[model samples]
Target chain A: MDIFLTLFINGLSEGALIFLVSSGLAIILGLMGVVNFAHGALFVWGGYAYVWIYQMTNSFILGILAAMLIVFILGIIFEKFFVSRLYGNAPAQILITLGLNIVFIEIIRLIWGNTPIAIKKPDFISGTTIINGVTISHYRILLIIIGISVLIIVNYILKNSKTGMVIRAGVQRSDMVQALGINIRLYFTIVFAAGAALAGLGGALYAPLAGNVISTAGANNQILAFIAIVIGGLGNFSGTAKASFLLGLMNAFVAWFIPSFAVVTNVLVMAIVLAFKPEGLFSEGRKSILRLAVKK
Target chain B: MKSLREHIQRDFSKNVIIALSVLLIALLIFPKFSSYTMLNLLTRIFVISVFAMSYDILRGYMGFINLGHAVYFGGGAYVAGILYNKLGTTIPVFILSIAVVVLYSVICALVMGKLSFKKGTSVFAAAMLTLALAEVVRNIAESWRDVTNGTDGLIFKVPSILSNRIFFYYFSLIFLIVMFIILRKFILSPTGRVIIAIRENEQRAEFLGFRIENYKLIAILVSGVSAGLAGLVFGTFNRFANTELLSITYSTNALLYTLIGGTGTLYGGIVGSIVVNVFQNMLLNLRSIHPIFERWLIFLGILYIAVILFMPKGIVGTLRHFIENRKVKSDNEKSSKTEKAPGE
Candidate 1:
């Protein structure tokens, strides 16, 4: 029972961390219909920025915020210049973003010297507690808190805010939104940057959990996020959240029993999903062409 | 009677034929006069150029991007290494490996095509799926230590006939020219034109009662078989097989080659491969002169971006576009002059 509880918490925390990364991807893909291949690069930058600032200032909050800020700026640049130019051209977008991915990843290696940088959890949350015969780590609890809050906050925004309304509309028809006199391009930049910042936040939190920041981590997590997006349905937010949790729980149980299966789980799940339901398990299956391309 | 320049200008095909035959003749005699390094380098280019050409069938012709393209190439090399190691490096074993490679490439293509080419699958989904599949294969290869040698890479001996560098160099050159002609023919075939039509307007192709998916699957199969063959030749040339062949770097290298040379143009891949490989070789040579030269990937990435942004049609595509535009301009001038002559 104690093991079960531990695993559950562990899994939820894992799912929450994944959520932080994939949520941005889900939003960006939803709003802009832009598949940002350099998202992994943005993620790595976030992690390195977090590590750099954390080491210098020793303030975890500051590091996380700084990471988000740096990545946000990078996101704006990518959307405005490179990705914006290649709108509606999926192949070119993929190639250009992939090129940017390679360049940015190499730049990370250049700055950080190609070695993994060690990191530690903040002093406050780096502790353990015993409750009702259950041993729970404070950090996991903190992760759960952060994860739920982000979900609730984002959900609230999507449900209640004008920005959410625009994003939702943009997903279906950005042109219609533009015809309605909303600055859809500004919204594109905002959503892309916000998604990038979320990825940055995920990276900052991820470093202490993994115990180090490495350039390759971005690629690895990017794959994980891709899996989530695939299973959850393209550009579906709530679906992404559900899929992320499902993956996390599945991974935790698999790791406990069939460790080898853990490595193969993502691929297996993805392949099965693709074979059976190419639209994804949680897809709305809209016949909207605009979401497929934000054409000029 | 026209001067030599005017005659050549009027008859483009004859001039191209003359230029190509002369180049081919020179290359046939190249090994004897060239140094060993030059011979080896050209041999490598010939083998890899086939791989690039195969990649162009998908990227250039069909407008599909398979990020796991290196899997077939890497799979071919591994098959060669493993079979040679297990069953003795005989001519029969080499033949057997070729057969195995074709079957393997076909099976992989079927699986990849079925998943990525499904109805409602977006461009993003296909790209991500292929990448995930490639990574899965790489992981499996890594963990299967007994066979793949656990990423330290599988090195084995080949038949002595293949080991003869001059013989192998000639072999690869023939392989390149033969494959190029075959692919060019394939592109011009009825089925190939249907595939190109699908690329131009998938909806129109579908509405025209063509099974676009089947055509795409065929494209994948042809590309796969060619890539696998190239990989086998590359392994024979180097006498080595590594998992790095399966890496995204190689897949992207294929992409870079096709993009630089011209995606749809069959020979563009050859040009791109030659240009990229030569540049890579030059950079390696420059490493002793500067520490910065060691990090060549930065430059590779920059080149990728620059080519896509500035040279979107690639070297061959851009050149062809320029030539076609000039021809149109000159023809317009000649037509106007003829009109004026009638008036006079």
Candidate 2:
């Protein structure tokens, strides 16, 4: 029972982190039709930024804000210069984003050196709380709270706001959105930056929990985010949340029970999901999760 | 005068003969003229060229961008390594290894095709699926310690005949030449034409009663086998099989080489592989001069961006475009000159 409880909390926290990373990816892919392979690089950048800022300022909040801001700016620059040019070209987009990822990762290496950087949990969130004979870390609770709150805020914005409406509509039919007199390109840029900010937030929040951040962390997280998006239907927020949680729980449980298979579990789940439901679990009908090159 | 079609055919055949003779002469004399290091480098280039060309068939001809092509390449190497390790690298064992690697690659490609080429699947989804699948394979390679030795990798000896550098270089060179000829012939075949048609317009090809999936499958299978063959040569040359072979970086390299050489042009793979390999070698040599040269990946990343931005068609592709344009201009000028002379 104790093991199960611990696993459940672990799963939820990990799920929240995944959700943080994947939601942004899903939004960008859905609205802009760009895969944005450098999304992971942004996440890594955020972690590094958070760690560096936290060390300098001794304030987690300031670190998180700085991380998000830095990544958001980077996202705007990326969307403007690199991604904007390859709007309809899938191959070019993949190649360019992949190159950007390499560049970002190399830059991180140059800045941070090869060693992984560890960030300590804040003083207030340093201890554990026991409930019903199960001990849960305060940081884990904070992560869950922050994750749920962000999800709610994002959901509310998407459900009610004009920009959110434009983004949602843009995902469905950019041509129609353009006809409606909204600059879809501007919306794309905004959404991309917003997504990058979310990824940054995820990285910053995850750093304390994971204890350390490595340059390759971005690539690893990127793969997990891709798996989450694939499993949940791409572009579906609710689906992403559910898939992230399920995958996180599965990963936690698998790690506890059969440790050898932990690394393969995420990939296996993705493969199985792809085999059974290629459109993904949350997809409505015949909508392919990722639309390739849009024929002009 | 002969028809334009006949003239073009004659010219094409003449070009083919000249190219083949040049290739043969280069193959024969290259080792004798170059140092052992250069020969080794050229051998690597040849192997990579075969791999790139196979990739080109899918990306260039079929218009399918497979981001996980290293699966087959690495799969072949691992299979060869395992076989060689177990069977003592005898002639028969080597032959069997090549055959097994090809079969394994075909099976993998078939499975990937079935999963990704479904009725409404987009190209991005397919690429992602392949990437995911390749990562899974890499993980397996990493964890399957009993077979792969995990990250430590498998280092084994090839047969005595292949131990000599010059002999092995010539052996791989011959293998590359033979594979190149086979690929060239395959590309010019009727099936190749159908595959090109599918690339040009899948819907039109389907409407014209061609089985697009089947053609794609055939193209992938051919590509997989050739890639597997190249991997076998690579593994034999290095006498090692490691997880790095299964990496997405290698797949990226293949894409980079094929794209830089020009898609659909068979020789573009050769050109791209040569250019990239030589450039990489140069960068590696420069590392001794400056520690900053160790940051070769940054340069490679910039190169990829530049290629995508400036020369999407690649070196050979751009060159072909230029030559064709010049030829058309000359043709126009000659026709005008004839018309003017008659008028005068």
Candidate 3:
């Protein structure tokens, strides 16, 4: 019973991490209609920047703020210079983003070397707490809190904020939005920057849990985040949330019950999702013309 | 009797001759000037270019962004490696391996297509599904220790297919040429036109009474077969097969080649492959000059950004655009001259 409780919390936290990283990707993909493969690299950039700042100032909050800002600027620059031209070209967008991802990862290797860097959790979030006879790690609880809080904040921004409304409008009809005298390209750039900031935030939050920030880990997680979006339905926030939790919990429980099955769980979940609900659990409206590009 | 300039402008034969002349010169000096170090680089480029061409069948021709494309390539590698190990087979195993991969991909495509045939699950969702499925396959290969040899990977003595370096180079060159011929023929065929049609408008194609799903399945199968062939060749050259070969990164590389070369063009695959290889080689060499340049991957990323933003049509596409513009200018000039000659 204790083991079950522990795994459940563990799964939720893992899901939260997945959510944090993928939510940014979902929003960026939704509004921009551009697939940013470099989003993972952005996440890595945030984590690495956080590490550098942490070393410089020894203030975790300052490190996170600086990291998020730096990555956000980089993201905006990426969109302005590169992603703008790839608006209608998925293949080129994918290729360019992938190359950027590699570049970001390699840059980290160059700056920090191959050694994995660890970020110490704040004393407040450090250690474990006994909850209902199951000892839960405090930092994981903090991560969950932070993830949920951000989700709420993002939801609020998308729902009530004017810019978010513009994003929704852009996602519906980019040309129409542009015709409305609003610069859809500007919206895309902003959304991409915001998404990058969110990804950086997620990475900063995740640093403690993962214990180390390895250059390749961000790319690996980015691929996993892609899986989450696929299973959750790309461009659907609620779907991404549910899928992340499902994936996280499944991974946690499976790892606990059958260690060998842990890695396979993600693929199995994706296969099941693809087999049963290829449109994802919360997919709504018509498929994009980009999909029509596929013969099927 | 037109002058050389007028005749050249009037006929496509002149352009073809010019292009072929450039190609012949490059190919002739390429092997001679390239030493062992450069040959190795060239060989790697050829391998990737072939891989990219395989991807172009689906991505460039059929307009499907299959994120799980490495599955076909990786499947070919594993199957060929295993068969070679068990039967001590050579090229025959490669053929069998590709056949198996095609069968596997066809089945997978059929299933995936059926589920995601709806309008909403078109682009990112479909590609994501394939990626997820490939990851699952990778995990299975990693876990299936008995057959795949687990994460430790499979290593074997280099088979005597083409022991000498020159022979191997020549063998790859011939294979590439033959494959290019086959691909060109396929692209010019009626079925190929239908594939392109599907890319332009699926609803229109469906309305025209075409079996869209069947076409997609077939295109995917062909792509899988080609990827398998590339993978088999790669395995033979490397003398090993690992999970990394079946990764998303490999798929991304192929996608890069097709994009940078320009989609929908006959020689886009070749051009894109060459560009990526040359760029990569240059980056690797740069690493020796400045250790900090080891992070050339970042430059690659930035380069991709530049390409997407500025060169959406890619190198070949840009060239074609220039040629077409010149043709238009010449036609306008001729029309103006004809107008001036009122008596004629």
Candidate 4:
């Protein structure tokens, strides 16, 4: 039971981190209809930024903030300069974003060198704590808290805020929104950057949890986030979050039991889900957001 | 003599005939004067061009974006490598590898087509699924350390004659010509027409009583077989096989090659492979000039973006567009000799 509890939290924490990345991805896909393949690069940037800041100041909060800020700016630049120009063009988006992904990842290697950078959980949240019969790592619990708070905060904002309404409207009809005198382009940039920032924050938090950050982690984690987004339904925010957790739990158990299956399980789930439910398990059976996203 | 000359002029362009003969003659004798590196680069280009052409069958001809195409290409290489390692490295083993690759490619294509062509699967999902399926194969290869050697990559011998550089270059050239002809024949066949029809309009093709999925499967089958064959030859040429051959980079390289040369045009793949491989070779040569040249991928990625943005139709496609446009304009002028010409 104690082992189960530990594993459960471990899974949840893993899911939380995945959610951080995919939620941003889902939002970007929803509003702009562009699947940011460069998302993984952004996540890597966040980790490197966090590591750089943490090493300089020894402040975890500052590191996370700096990571988010830098990634947000990058997000804006990507949207304004690259992604925006190719709006409504799906294939170009994939190619350009992938190109950006490669370039940025190479840039990371250039700066950080090829070695993995090590980091530790901060002193306050470094140790494990016991609650009744359940013992949990403090850092993981913090991650869970951060994940949930971000989820709630974003949910609240999306539901009640003007920006949220505009975003949802833009997804349905960006031209319509533009006709109404809303600068849809600005929204696209802001949302893309915001999504990037979330991925950055995920990276910042992920470094301590994983013990180190490596350049290759971006691609590996990007695949996981892709699986999550696919299973959750592309452009469906809530579905993506659910899929991430399910994947995290599955990964945790698979790794714990049959370590060899760990690599295959994520893809296997994606295949099965794709085959059985092409619209995704949680999707509302609306048109494929992808079809709607592309230019005629 | 005038009749014969008129017949030749009527059937084919004199420029095309002259160009083809000149290019073929040059290819035949150029290896004698070329550096060893240049000779080998051409050989690699030949094998990889076939892979790109195979990819064109799907992406250009069928409008399917398969992110896991490396599965067949890399699978062929691995099968060739593994078979050569386990069995003896001989001409017979090479023949046996061809048989194995054909079977493997067919089965994988069927499964790949099935997984990605579900009832409600979108193009995006299909693409992602292909990537997932590839990752699964790669994962299996990585873990199955006993057979695959666990990503350290399998090094093995090839048939004796294939090891010779000049022999292999000519051999790959012949291989390229054969595959190009075969692929062209396939594209011109009735089944290939239906596949093109599906690409142009899936619904209309379905309504016309063609089983869209079956046609798609057929396309994938042909593509996989050819791509696998390319890999088989590539592995033999390299005397090595690695999981990297099964990676997204390799798959994307096929996309890049096809895109650069212009998709759908068989000759474009040949041109693309030559252009890309030569460009890559040049970049590698520049490594002595600057340490940054070692990171040529950044430049490659930038080139990729630039191609997608500015030359979306690719070199051949754009050139064809221009030539075709000019021909149309000239034809219109001939038709309306007195009327004002249409605006560009």
Candidate 5:
């Protein structure tokens, strides 16, 4: 019972972190049709920024805020200058983003060197809380709270706001959205930037838990994010969230049982999911999906 | 007197023969003139060129961008390494190793193709599936300590003759040239025309009564076999097969070389491999000049971006396009001149 309880929290917290990163990826891919391979770079950048700022100011809030801001600005610049140029070209987009991923990792290496840097949990969230027979860290609780809040906020914005409506509509019918005079290009930029910010936030949140941030962190997380989005359905936010949690739980359980195969389990799950449900679990039965499935 | 089209065809064939003879002569004499290090680099280029060309068969001809192509390359290398280590580098062992590697690659392609090329799989989904599958292979290579030695990698000896740089260099060159000829022949055949038609427009090709999936499968199998052969040569040359061979980095390198040289053109692989390998060697040699030279990956990244933006057709493709344009212009001028003279 105790093991199960611990695993539950472990799974949920990990799933929350994954959701933070992958939801952004899912949303951006859905709306903009760009894979954003460099999304993981934003996550790593956030972690590094948080560490650097935290070391200087010794304030967790300031560190997180600074990290988010820097990544957000970088995301905007990336979308405007780089991603905007390769809108309709899938191969070009993949290559450019891949190159950007390498560049980002190299930049991180240049700044921090090859060694991993560890970050301390904030003093306020450093303690552990015991519930019944199970012990959970304060930071884990905080992470869960933050994850739930972000989920709610993102869901609300997407459901209620005008910009959200534009994004949703644009994903469904870009031509119609453009006809509606919504400045669809601007919306794409915003969506890309917002996605980057979410990835950045995920990085900042995960830094303390990860203990150390390395250059490979982005590439590592990027794979997990890819798996999550694929399993959830490429463009479905809710599906991504649900898949993230399921994958997180599976990961935790697998790691506990067969430590060597933990890393591969996500890939296996993705493969299985792809084999069974190519259109993903949450995608609507649109003509595009049908076209993708049929050999014309 | 031949018709204009027949004359053009004869001229093109003649030019091709001349170009190929020159390349063969250069490769044959290269080892005698250059240092051992240069021979080794050229050998690497030859092997990589074969790999890149194989990749082009899928990416350029079939329009299926496989991001996990290194699985076959690594599969070949590992098979060769393991066989050489256990059974000794006998002629039979070498042949067996190559056979196994090629078979492995075909099977991998069959499974990956079935999963990704199913009716509704998008380009991104297919790429992602390949990436995931490669990662899975990498993880297995890392964890299967008894066989792969778990990331420390396996280093084994090849045949005594292959130990000599000159002999191996010639061997790889011959292999590359042979593969190039075979691939070129395949590309010019009727099946090749159908494959190109699919690339140009898949739906239209299917509507025209072609079995699209079967042709794609054949392209992928051919690609996998050639890539496996390249990897077999690479393993023999390096005498080491490690997880890095199976990683996304190597796969991306193949993509980079193919794209930089030109996608659809046969010789694009050779041109791209030579350029990238030479540039990489130069950068490594420049480490003493400045510490910034250590950051070569950044420069490579920038090159990728620039290639995509300005020269998407790549070096060979762009040059060919320019020459073809000039030829067309001259032909038009000549036709107009003849017509004017007749009128006058």
Candidate 6:
């Protein structure tokens, strides 16, 4: 029972981080039709900023907030400078984003010198809490709460906000949105920046969870985010959240029972998902979308 | 005489002659310019260029960016490495190894293709799947150390026939040239035209009665076969195969080469491969001269960005544009001279 409980919490915490990173990716892909491979770089930059700030100021909240703000600014700059030029061409966008990713990853390595930095939970949340004969770290439980809170806030904005409405309309048809006197190009820029900020937030939060921040981890997280987005359905926020949770649980369970299977399990799941629903679990309307596109 | 000249002009006879001459000269003189070590390095580059060509068949012709292509190439290397260790050095074993790798690649392709059949999975999704699968394969290769020789990487005595670095370089060059010929024939063939059409518009091609999936599958298979051949050559040349060869870097390198060479032209793949390899070699060699130049990844990233922004059409495409422009200019000049009126 303890083992199961521990696994569940661990998985949930990991899933939360995955959800934070992937939601940004899912939203950008769904609404703007831009596959930002540099999302991973944002995550990496966020972590590095947090660590740098924390080392300088020694205040966790300030460090994290500063990091998030930096990422937000960087995201906006990136959209304006780089992503703006690659609005419609996916292959070119992918190449540019990949190039940006390499530059960011290398910069991190150059600055940090390839050494893993130690990341600790703030002193206030440093202790463990025992409940129902199961011991859970307080920071981990905090992670779950934080994840839920962010999800609610984001979902609320996505569903009810005026900008969210614009995003939905743009997703339906970029040209039609422009026809309606809305500048979708501007919306796409804001969306990319927002996505970067969210990814930054996820990276900042994940620092303590993983106990270290490293350069290559962004690539690893990027892969995980991609897998999550694909499984959950490429533009669906809810689907990504659910898929992240399921994958997290799956990894935790596999690790406990058969540790070797933990890595392979993700690939096996992807293969199965690809076989069963190539459009993904939530891509119900893409067929019609494709048909409409073809007619045009 | 005019009709004969026109026929010769339309046939690409001159272009073929120029390309072959350049290739022949490079193959013969490259060894003399560089030492044994450099010869070996160039040979590896040639093999990898062939691998990039494999990727080009899928990415350029079939319009499918397969992220998992290293599986076949790496599989062949491992197969050959294992075979060389267990069974004595025999040419037949190399052939069998190639077959085994091709079979493995085909099975993997069928599975990946079936899963991604809906609107043919997005480039990002395919890349993610392949990256994940490569990691899985890497883990398997690591854990199954008994067979893979684990982190040490499987190494064997160099094959007697290819013991001389120059001999191996020449052999690989021949293999690359032959593969290029095959690829040229494929791209020029009716089937190749259909593949190109699918890349332009899959639904339209399907409406035009082409079996889109079947063609994609065949393209993938041919690509796998080429990768397998490259892998066999790589294993023989390096005398070892490691999990690194099956990494995301390998896939990325191939992708980068295709992008650099100009995917629209057959020779672009070869040019891209050579360019990147030469650049890398120079960077590594000059590390002592400029310590900061050790950051090769940064340079490569900048290069990728530059290529994407300025040379979107790639090297061959740019060259073709210039050549066509010159021809047009000459034709205009000839026409102007023939005209008697000043307005003309």
Give the fraction of reference interface contacts each candidate recovers: 0.70, 0.55, 0.81, 0.70, 0.70, 0.74
Name the candidate, 4 or 5, with the larger lDDT value.
4
Estimate, for each residue in B275-303, the C-alpha lDDT of model 6 and write its tens digit.
Answer: 88888888898899986667787888788
Report the C-alpha lDDT of model 5 over A29-124, residue by residue, as the tens digit: 765678888888899998999999999999999999998898888788888989999887777888888878878888888778889898889899
Best by TM-score: 4
Give residue B71's lDDT in candidate 1 (0 to 100): 90
Candidate 2 lDDT over B204-254, as tens digits, reads 999999998888889989998898889888998888989889887888889
lDDT digits (tens) for residues A70-181 of candidate 6: 8888888878888888777877777788888888788788778788999887888878988898889888888788888888988888878999888777766888989999
- Alpha carbon lDDT of each predicted model: 0.87, 0.85, 0.76, 0.87, 0.84, 0.80
lDDT per residue as tens, model 4, B1-344: 45445635643487888898898899999888999888989999999999999999998999888889999999999999999999988999999999999999999999999988776777777888888888888877888889989789999988889899999999999999999888977887789889999999999999999999998999999999999999999999999888999988788889889888988887778878988888888999999999787888777778877888889888888887998899899998887865555643
Residue-by-residue lDDT tens digits, candidate 3, A206-236: 7767877877778668877888888877667
- Which CAPRI tier for candidate 3? medium
Write out the backbone clash pairs for model 1. Answer: none
lDDT of 2 at B121: 65
Point out where model 3 deviates above 4 Å. A85-95, A169-188, A283-296, B1-34, B89-119, B149-153, B342-344
Give the range where candidate 4 chain B is weakest over 10 consecutive residues by summed lDDT. Answer: B3-12
Model 5 per-residue lDDT tens digits across residues B1-344: 23434634733677787897897798898877899889899999999999999999988788788878999899899999999888998879998898898889899889888778777677888898888888888888888888888899988988888788898888888898899889987887778889999999999999999998888888888898898889888998999999999998888888888889999887888899999999989988998999777888878778877887889998988988898898999999999999999789
Q: In candidate 5, which residue pairs get closer than 3 Å at backbone N, Cα or C atoms, i.e. clash? A: A292-B120, A293-B119, A293-B120
State the lDDT of candidate 3 residue by residue for B1-344, as single tens digits: 13434534543466798897897578656776678777666666666666778788888787778788888777777777787788775666656666776677667656555544445565666676677677778888999999899898887544576545666776676677777767766766667778889999998998999998777776776667677777777777777899888888777777777778877674677888888778877888888788866666666666655666677677788888988899899999999999989977
Report the C-alpha lDDT of model 1 over B155-236, residue by residue, as the tens digit. Answer: 9999999999899889999999999878877887788889999999999999999999999999999999999999988987
Q: Candidate 2, residues A52-150: lDDT per residue as tens digits?
A: 999999998999999999999999988998898888887789888888888888888877887888778989888998889899998988888888888
**Least accurate 10 contiguous residues by lDDT in model 5 chain B:** B1-10
What TM-scores do the predictions have?
Answer: 0.94, 0.93, 0.88, 0.94, 0.94, 0.92
Better of 4 and 6 by DockQ: 4
Query: What are the runs in model 6 whose C-alpha is more than 4 Å off?
Result: A170-184, A282-296, B1-19, B29-33, B118-120, B341-344
